[model samples]
Target: LIKEYLPGVSILFPYRLLKTEDPLPHSWDVTSDTIAAWVAKQTSALFIKATDVDGIFGEEKVIKNILASDFSEHFDSCIDPALPEFLQKNKMECIIINGKFPERVIQAVYGRPVHCTTVKGNI
Candidate 1:
């Protein structure tokens, strides 16, 4: 279906197993955020997580940008539990933005500045 509709674009379904080999975990820890990051790592594309919140929050403040090395040093919110570690390990960055506002999604896709949290890769 993807080849006929989206063409070159690729989409990963966390709930659906493509095959018996190397399947993702069927646990809550693996949400769409982590799934997207995993897909990005596989496709060599950027990963962006659109959530209801503006971004990740810790200590009552929104962390705008952070490196993967320091990603574990903060409170977890707005993303799946396994996302940060997976992204860091794969050297893949992830941008978390507000899905409530559709424009932010476009901004994130284009690498434009948006009110979001950028979890840096291991580079």
Candidate 2:
């Protein structure tokens, strides 16, 4: 069990019944929606998203920081389509880093600067 390994970590699996028939819930949609709802009721927390690449790319280079308002459908390949809108609407922010390197992930959790993309909705 996860608790056995990381006792301090709390894992939550959230699901909601949709009105649409036979529509499978998209994982990213669930994540974004769940975060939005939880953020409304809790203290602000850093959202770190791990992926294969270093971060979001633009013009063949990583975009260190970007505004949610500047996000477009073209970025759906890198993140969930619903996430940008959710961040902008909620005035939240998230950092994207490469999961391939565990050390970077650790650094991120510790609030240390790392080579990553920061999607800012808090602007």
Candidate 3:
């Protein structure tokens, strides 16, 4: 489906969504965040997820920028546990922003100063 809409953006949606015969593994660790990142990888695009929270909370604060290693410490709380590993292995970054503030998404995409969290692949 992504290829059919090449150069365009679309969130990852499983073939049958909640239906059975799941093409992908059925695991709690493989949530929407990981699926979105996987689609971006296959398409060579950026990955983003707008969640309800302000951003990734860590060390008693909303971490604006963090390495995958450090973020993994709080990964289970912020996102699918497998995402950090996948991003690290692929040398990719994921921008997590608050859906309440849609404008922040644009800033994140531009790598600007936004009230969001950027999870980097490297140390």
Q: Best candidate, lDDT-wise? A: 3
- TM-score per candidate, in order? 0.76, 0.71, 0.75
Q: Which residue pairs show backbone clashes in model 1?
A: none
lDDT of 2 at 53: 91
* Model 1 lDDT per residue over 78-122, tens place: 777777678777877888888899999998888789999888868
Runs of candidate 2 with Cα error greater than 4 angstroms are 1-6, 16-43
Task: Report lDDT (Cα) of residue 96, candidate 1.
Answer: 82
On residues 1-123, what C-alpha lDDT tens digit does candidate 2 reach at each position? Answer: 112337676654333323332233456554553453344324466778888999988898889999988877665546676777677767777788999999999999898999999888755
**Residue 61 shift from truth in candidate 1, angstroms:** 3.2
Rank the candidate models, highest lDDT first.
3, 1, 2
Q: List per-prediction Cα lDDT, in the order shown.
A: 0.74, 0.69, 0.75
| Pairwise lDDT winner, candidates 1 and 2 | 1
Q: Is candidate 2 or candidate 3 better by TM-score?
A: 3
